[model samples]
Target: MRPPSELTFRAVALGLLIGCLLCFTNLYFGLQTGWISMMSLQSSLLGYLISLLIPSVSPLTPQENVILQTTAVATGTMPLAAGFVGIIPALGLLDRAKDGMDPIHVLWWDGVWWCCAVAFFGVFLAAPLRKQVIIKEQLAFPSGTATAQLISVLHKIPPPAAARPGLRHRNGHTGSEDGYQAVRTVEAGGDIDEDAEDPGETDQKREEIVRAGWTTLGWSFAASGSMTLAAYFFPVIFAIPLLGDYLASKWLWTFSPSLSYVGQGIIMGFPTTVSMNLGMLVGWGVLSPLSKKAGWAPGDVGSMTDGARGWILWVALAVMCAESVVSLIPVVLELLRVLRANRDGHPEEDLETETEDRLVPMKWVLWGTGGSVVFGTIIVWYVFGSEGIKPWATVLGFGMGAVLSLLGVRALGETDLNPVSGLGKISQLVFAIVQPGNIVANIIAGGVAEAGAQQAGDLMQDLKTGHLLHASPRAQFHGQLIGSVLSIFVTTTAYSLYKRAYPIPGPNFPAPTAYVWLSLARLLRDGQLPAYSGTFMLAFGILGLSVSSLKTWAGLQGKWWAKWVPSGVAFAIGFLNTPAFSIARLMGGIVEFWWRKRTGGNRSANITLIVIASGFVLGEGIVSVVGLVLRTFGIGVASCWGCAEGVCPSC
Candidate 1:
């Protein structure tokens, strides 16, 4: 069985199930609070990484491969989970004709449709792109790196044995031992034409190739697992807030109202730095000194953990999500398309007269695709349209979802404007059309923001990994069906209950971008938000993005500096994500480069560093997972000790 088909099935199934639940919960919270709640499953990317490590019962089949791929693609984009709000508009199921829909209902069902749409897009849109962009361009999509690593292993071989047997001849021919001893007596060397192939050499070459395959599989699994593990754990050790620092920062200002060092780390500028340093002071300086004075513990793990953890965790999560989608998707689709084209031999194009040896069959794709459609239809019918949706509304939602996916793919391409993100935008637009009340508007907007912020980059990579493994894409899709079903039911129910009791306040300003549109819809109903300033900001931002004079100049010049400068500026901006984080990363990169150069490019050292970095990634991810779990239980953490009692501290 293929890697994704066999090993990834259960993992994909469970992950998707959990992810869907997280989205549902977030939707529920959005409705109750009149704002999006960051307490859903997706609130923590690190947590999901950990779950991937746990081995589960996999329904080993080619169909499972598609399920795994679909799950990864869906979760990787994460926006799809969060983007359910967009589906509301596409379906036209909201009661906008009479008045606005309720925020609570919108949040609960928006996610249901959003997930359905993403699953559809992952199959249909990605299928076509597999041939056009990925295979044709030979683009090195990083997401498929895992897949490539797996394939490279399968075609490898081991080294040949050293010894080979030779034919024995009569004594006169000097072939046997006795004849060889009588060197002088041997027959005159007649026809000493040595133009024969060496069996030993050929055997050795075959062995080497075979050995390569085993080595590749072993290494790939290890690397993949290590990466997942690192992402799971590192965040916890470094991402949580220091209790002492929290007390000092917030307590200095207000008693028993300390800030989470980790939370502050996520702030844009000085806040993160100040929060981290303060956390360190509490963890290392205050806590450590007190511990030493009290002679409680010898080591200072507390201080070490006290750095402004949450701030960096959130930012890193954002960056990781973005980088993952950007680097992984196109290559995956391209590779899969190439493999499929090569295997099946495009009949119309007359690409080939024969089919290539394939690990997976085309029938699996059809089955998986069919399965996705069925499951998706069921979800929409049962979940999203279960409300006042007319009987025909079910078909309408599904058809519209398909159409929207196509449009989204065209606009976003294999690289950007992910259908899932677009889904959130679309849902928000629909909510506006229906004019759900202000509460509904705020909830829907929050859902959109969360969806948009999800990592399109990761989804691309997950698909890439599946493609390279020769795993069944259809099976991966099926796994997605299982996961999504579980996730939607659990997360949604939990979040709805939380919202009924405690709702977060909406911002005075509108959501970042698409949410801005949602806010506009609300103005039509309540006229509560500022309109002119939001419009001005939008226009200015678009104008900034539109200026192509510089792009044209660079294109004309064809100068290296012109290209390098912009990239350098971008790097600088990225580095300023967080002072400590950027600095640490820079230092780590420098150390790695220097080590590689010193060792003459020793791979072992590189691998070691990768392992360590992976740990950091995992640690941060786990921390978020904890927060999401807590939120599901209606735990509004205000301080280290307890959560918000429906009071706004920031206010």
Candidate 2:
């Protein structure tokens, strides 16, 4: 019989349900704000709670929890396949919406199949790199590691149990020989320790940790849920309106007293929050005033306006795209070095352990990747005729996807940032240069590349979690595949309903990412830059290149300043978003900093803090989704004052 601890129906179903909910939530928020919360920790917390409700079922094993999270993340991230809900529709607005020219029109499936096809390649691409990136290189996939630790603690399992004996093939370390040793190495920063002096003492300490975790989870849930409910009823009380009128001015600010942003700030940390604030200052205080003086920004200098902000975005996009290309040089070189080493008979340790059971089969990766490429090409060619997108161009797009996936996964493993948009911009630049004035082809190519890279990065992170729990790679792969398939349907349907309820670019749905894509496409199609655009582009591009160069230099010198240099991409994103969001995030970071100091470096306390912060984010997300649904049905509480005054279109 199969092992009782293996992947079970209950786990899969629970994971899918959680993923469906989060996917729906993502659809709502991604259109409304263009940002989505990570679901790994949230899924673990919710899954553990739901598992407790199953009658006559044994407790969930660490491996089972890993399966649950892997599935949920795959499902949750699927909404990104929508391509920001602006791309396909923007094609219509740009006069390229002909039946045979636009993918959505010809395919007649809202681009869902295209998204799935590209994302499938991501999973296959990530499969082979699991051992090399996670085990041998030991990249710090922070979110994945945290999920593994959460699973271990919640399941009340010892550290040794976290790493399955059957999966112990690392450097010939069998489960019976060094399973505990392996677990000890991975769980060094975690709470558990198998090599403690007293077995009984260690057990007692673990029990205490578990008890504390549960207690913290309960309070966090209550607090977060209550706060979210309060915000729903009294948004004005929770959100402090600032700056110009909400509807009259495209750029508005509101001091949001939401714990959700605070929790996000904590997760993002002080450096990131500070950098975001700096970006905000530059965008609003410095750039807006300068643009106004230049006679292009048609607004009052005293008030921040999106018109001025638009200039910054254009410049930022250019810089971000350039930096993204520069960043890939090292990754490409590293990959080439690995290939040369393997060919020279000095195979990396990961390549040396080529047993079938320990790694994903090479045949599956090659066949799956090849099949996805062929299918994607057919879709592109069918949607857009040879004039719009040649077969070779389609092939080239997927090649870019493959390369970007490798780079994206590596970046995520190191920094917990996928750089999807940056990679997309790279694709857009490449296609723009190759197929000048072909707006339809350019956008499609970029979207496809971004979708592929996004999925690959997500899968690699899941693999990291699986590695930590010693879960079967095959089982995790199945879970991810199932989740991805389900997400395609669920998210597509959610987007449809959301669009019908509140069309994008409306007051309720900003669709920021989509707007960015549309603007870039227009600029490329017109072949004319806005006045002063080149100046700002050159300036920001130099700034980005300089910063990247400095970062590389610092790394080589082992300088302390390397860690403090804020991510240029983060700064760009922050500048593009409303300043109020940065303020809210800063508030959250302050809370986290205080809590950490109060805890005096207690691991258990830190875990509790994370759980609580995650609760805040989850609660806010769920509440916001519910509110949107209610608004869609016209059944929510009385409309807010802004809505009543004709400012909120959805309301």
Q: Could you say which candidate leads in TM-score? A: 2
Candidate 1 per-residue lDDT, tens place, 315-429, comes to 2222222322332244345456656987897643422211233223456546654565566546544553445332243333334444444433322332222323324334444
TM-score of 2: 0.83
Q: At residue 356, give the lDDT of candidate 2.
A: 57
Model 2 agreement with the true structure over 1-651: per-residue lDDT tens digits: 342244678778888988987787666556654556556766876777677656633566678888888888788777675464445544543443422343333233645765655658788888987877887777656566656766765665544333422322111000000000001112224345444324243545545655665577667656766776765555553445555465223445555666767776776666656766877777766776577678766654222133675667676676556556556666667678777877899745543333356457789899999998999788667666677677888899899988887887776665455667777777888998888877777878887787787777777767777777778777778788888888888877776666666655555565555656766866776766656868888888888888866754564355656646755655665656666567887887677668767876455566666777666766666666666676677765453664223333433
Clashing pairs in 2: 262-588
Candidate closest to the true structure, highest lDDT: 2
Candidate 2 wrongly placed segments (more than 4 Å): 1-5, 85-108, 135-138, 156-191, 195-239, 243-251, 299-306, 347-355, 380-392, 552-561, 636-651
What is residue 269's positional error in candidate 2, in angstroms? 2.0
The clash number for model 1 is 85
| Per-model CA lDDT versus the true structure | 0.33, 0.64
